[model samples]
Target: MSSPASPTIPIDGPTMDALMALMRLIAAGVTDDDAINDALGGVLGADSDSPQPAGTSPVSSAALGRSPTGETPSVSPFDAVVPLPADVPDVTDTDDGGSVPTEATNTDGQPMGLSPLEFAVLRQNSHVVTGLLKAGASVDYIGGFSCTALCKCCYSFHKNVDLIRILLAAGANPDATTNNDTHSASCLIISVVKNNVEAVKALLEYGADVSYEWKGSNALAMALDFKKLDIAQLFENFEYRKAQKNRWERYQNQRRRDAEDREAKLDALRSRSAAPTGESPTPQPVDGRSTPTGRDETRSPSHAAGGGTGSPRSVRETAQLTENLGAMDWLVPLSDIEWGQQISAGAHGQVFRVTLKSTGDIVALKRFPCHDARSREGFRREVELLTKFRHENIVMFKGAVIDADVSAMLTELCTESLFDRLERTSAPIPWPVRLRWARDIAKGMTYLHTRTPAVVHRDLKSMNVLLDGSGTVKLCDFGIARLREHTFVMTQHIAGSPSWMAPEVLRGDDFGPASDVYSFGVVLWELLMRQVPWPNKNMAQLVGLVGFAGSTLELPDRAPEGCPPQFIDIIRSCFAKPEDRPSFRSLREQLDSLLVDVD
Candidate 1:
C-alpha cells in the first residue's frame, strides 16, 4: 500500500478540532501504533524522531512538534462559511446558526479548511485511505460534516476516480440515500458525470445499481446531461452500453438488407433484358449462326427446330450465300461515302467537320466504332434522344448513318468547347460575363433535367459545353448523356470527368441530379479560381484525401474587386449535399437579384 504524502491544513485551534473530529469519525478502532503513525504522519507531514510512546516508532516522536494536518498556526476570526453555492446543498445545520458553519467560520463567512497541500493529498491519497480501511477505518464514517469520503472526493474535487475506487472497495454504499434526499454516493455519479467508461464498466461489473434514482437523475441521465455520447451509448442496458450498441447493430443490419436488395435487382438486370411487361425474355442471336444449315436438302420442319412459322425460304437463301458474295458486297459500301476532315477525338467518338454535298451545309459528323451489338444499339438510342430534344442551348442532331461496321451522327457545328475558350483567355472572364455564362448554363441544365423524358447529361464537363461565335452556350456531346430510366442508353467506360465526378459517382454508385450539382460545383470552382478543378492530382488520391480527411477543393484567395459575396456563396452552395443544394430555379432567382443589385 502507498503511504499518504502529507497534509496542508493549518495547525490553528479550530483546525485541530476539525482534524480531531475527522479522525474520531473515520479512524474508529485505530489502536495499532504504525497505523496511527501512518495516518498522523501523512496528514501532519511528519519527520522521524527517536523519542516516542509505546508501539509508536521513533517516527512518531519526529511528528510530535509538527502542526496537526499541517494547518496554519494563525487563526483568522473574520473568515467564516457562507451559504453554499446553489448547486452544492448545505450539509451543515446542526449546532451553528442558519448561516452555514465551518471549522474557521469568521465574520465574512468563508469556510476554512486544510491548507492547499492538505487538500491535494486528501484528494489523491485514496490509495493510502484504502490501506487504512483494510487496517480498519470505518467505511461509513462521514469526514468533517455529513459528506462521506467518496462524496468529498468526487463532489468537493472534480472527477477523483482514485479516491472513488478506494471508498467503493471499502464497501461504500453507492446507492445510499441521504437524510436530506440527495443521493450522496458520488462515486457512481462521478463515473456518469465524467463520462468515465471504465469506471462505469467496473461499477456495473461490481453490481452498482443501474435503476437507483439519484435526485431524479441516474447514471443514464448524468451521462446524457454531460453529453458524453460514448458513455451514454454504453448505458443501453446494464447502465446503458448495450442499447447504443444494439442500435448501431440494427442500423448496420438494415444497410446490409438494402444492399442485398439492390444487388438482387442488379443481378437480375445483368442476366437478361427487361421486356415491355417487366419480364426477362429469352435471348436470340442476331447473327443467325445458331440456326442450322441445309434446310432445303434435309427437308426438316423449320417450326420444329427454330420455333418459328416456316421461314425456310429466307434461311435457305442465307445458307446458299458463299464467302465470295459476302465479301464483294461489303466493299461496295465503303466507296460510296466520303470521309471528312477530323475535328476532334475523345474517349467516346471521333468528330469531323463534314460538308454535306446534297444539303450544302457544314455539319459535325461523329462516328462511334462498333465493338458490340449493345454499343450499336446505344448509339441508335442517342440518335433518337437527340432527334427529340430541341432547345436554344442544345445542339441539334440532323440524322444518323447506320453502317455494317460503325454508327455516325450528323449535328450542328460549334466553334469550340468552353475549356478551349478559357485556355485561350489569359485573364479571368469579366464578372458580368461570368455571371451571364453561369446563368445560361444553369438554365440549360434546368431545361434538360425538367424535360418530360428527363435527359441527364451524365458527363457535364467544360469540354462537353460548346460555344458558338455569338457566345451562345450549347450543351453538346450526347454520347454519354442518358435519357432517364433507360438502361439501354450508353454508359461510357467511365461516366464523368474526374475533377467533376460526385462523391457517389466516385464510389461507383449511379448518380442523379445531385451528382449534376456536384459537377456544377467543380465548374464553379474552376470559373472562380481560374484553375483546373482537382488540379494536377489523380482522381483516386484527391477523392480519398478529401472524403476521408474532410478536405475540400481550395478556393481562390482573392476574387475580382467588387465581386459580390452572393455569387461566391452561390459557388459554395453548389458544393453542398444534394438535399442542401439550391435548385436551378432558385439559383437563377438569386443571380437575377444579384445582377439587379450590381446594376
Candidate 2:
C-alpha cells in the first residue's frame, strides 16, 4: 500500500511578513544593524511597552516556529518563505511562463525552496548573512541552480566583495562550484568571467586553487582570454612565491643539519681532551678523517700531538687554537679570541677589533646580526666569498664564527680607513703615498673584475679602503657587491652611498665594471681635496645634480698643485660614459706610471 502524503505546514502571517521584509533589506544591500532592526521591527510589530534597544529586533524565536524557551523547531520557519520578484505571481499560478513549484509553502499552499543564506548573499546583505551563519546556516548550502553562497556572490550582477569576504571568513570554500550539467565552474572561474578583479583577488587571497578546471578551462586561461594581464601575472607571482618559500625551508633545514654536525664534532673533541693520558683513546672519524685520540687533527702537524722542536706554546695558547679548529672545521671559535673596541656600526652589522689569543694575531671581525633567515644566508655567502679571495691588496680573510644570534668574519685588521686619515690631517697626503694608495685600490678592483664572473664592488668609497700600520691600503667591505653576468648586472633598487655612487647607479640603471670606476673617481677626488664629496649639498640635491645635471666634482685650481696631469685625466676618463671609462687594468697601469714619475 502507498503511504499517505504529509500535510503541508503553513507559514503564519507575521512570519511571512518578517521574511519578506528581510528579503527586501537584503535586496537593498542594507547591512547596517540599526536599519535592519528598524525594518524587521516594523514588519514583526515593535513592542512599545517593553522598549527594546535601538539595534535589537522585536521578533522572537517563538514567532519563527520555535518553542517559547527558544529551542530550535523541527523545521526552520525560513524554509516556508521563498524570495521571488515582488511583481511575480505566486507558485500556485502557473501561466504560459511555466514557473515550477518551490519547496517552501505559504498560507495559499505554495512551495518556495530558497535557502535563507543563499537569499541573503544574493541580495548582498552581509548583516543577514552573518545572522544566518549565527543561526547555524550551512555556508555550503546548495540552492537554485545548485549554486553555493560563495559561487552566487562571485557571479552576482553587482560586485559584492564584502559579502564574499564574509562568506569566505565563515568557512565558505573558495573553490566551491555550481552543479551545472552543461558547464560547472568554481567561484574563482565565475569571478573571472564576471570581470570582477576584486572578487578574484579576494578568492585568491583566501587560498583559491588556480589550477582548478571547469569545462576544460581554468582561472588562468580565463584571465588571459579576458586580457587581464595583472591577474595572470598574479598567478605566476604566486607560483614563484611558493617556490621561493620551499627553497628557503630547504636551506634552513640544511643549515640546521650543518650546525648539529659541528656541535657533535665539538662534543667529541671535548670528551677526548678530558680523558686520562695513560689510556689511549679511540679515534673518531668525521668527514672521512679519523681524528687522532688525545690530539686535535685539524691543527697543523707542527703544533699537534706534542710541542714542536721550537718553544712549546702555553696551555692557554694550545687550548685556544685546538678548541677553535675543532668547534668549527672552517671557522674559529670566539672563545679563543678577545674583542676590543667596536670599529664601526651599520644597520645590519658591526665591525670590531679582535686578537687571536694563540698567536696574538690582530684581525677585524665583522659581526652580522642574524635578525632573520635571509640575513644569515647573506652572512654565510659573504664569508664564503671572502674565503676564496687571495689578492695582496684585498683584505685577507682569516676565518668566521657562525652562531645562532650572530655570525662573524675575521680579516686582517687595518689601522684606519683612507677617509679617516684624510679627515684627521689638515695637510694633503704626500704625492707618493697618494699615488701608491690609488694603485693599491686599482689593483684590488682589477683582481675582482677579472674573475670568471666579474665581481663588481657596488659600494666603493674612501671609507671602504683601509690603510694598515705600514701605510699599505687594502680594499674592504663587500656588503653590496654583485657577481656580474656577462659585462653587466642589474639591481631592482639603488644601493651604495649617494655621494660616491655612479650616475648610472643613481638613475637605477645596470651596473658594470665602469660603475665601479665612477665611484673610484669620486674617492680619488676625496683624497686629493682632503674633504668629503659634496660637503655642502645634502644627499637628495647631490644625487639630482650628479645624476640629472651631468655635474662633476669641481677641481680646485690652488689645491693638488703638484698633482700629475695624468691623475686629473684618469679622473675625467672615469666619469665619462660607461663605454668610454677606462678598465681597472688600464687605470692600474696608468697609476703605476704616475708612481714611477713621483719616485
lDDT of 2 by residue, 1-599 (tens): 01112233344456556666666666566778887666555444523333445764333332332121223543443433244446433333222233333333444544333555656654455788887666555576443325566775676432767888888888888887654223578888887777777788888789887767776667776676688867766654554444334435545666788789999998997886786768865565543456555775433222222323322333333333334334345566556668799998875489999888878998889998755545554565566668778998889988876443236789998868899898877765778889899999999999999998889988899989998889888998886677863221122123578788787665445668899999999988876778788776544444434544356787765446668877888888989988999999999999999999988
**Pairs that clash in candidate 2:** 102-111, 104-111, 104-112
Candidate 1's displacement at residue 115, Å, is 31
Model 1 lDDT tens row, 1-599? 01122222333343344335334423243345565455544433321222335654322222221222233322221111111222322323311223232232323443433222122224344444554566444444432323444444444433455666666777766653332135444456666765567666656665666545566656655665688867655554341233233334545666788789989987986675556666655543333233334334323211222234324553332222221122222111222335578988976788988776555667788887645544554565566667777887888767654433335777788868777767656855677766766777788888888888777887887888888778788887766677654221111234567678765554434557777877877776666666667665454443333322223576655556757777778877887766788877777778777767766
| Model 2, global lDDT | 0.66
Per-candidate Cα lDDT values, in order, are 0.53, 0.66
Task: Measure candidate 2: CA RMSD.
Answer: 20.1
Best by lDDT: 2
Please state the error at residue 161 of candidate 1 in Å.
32
- Estimate the overall C-alpha local distance difference test score of candidate 1: 0.53
lDDT for 430 (candidate 1): 71
What is the overall TM-score of model 2 with all chains considered together? Answer: 0.45
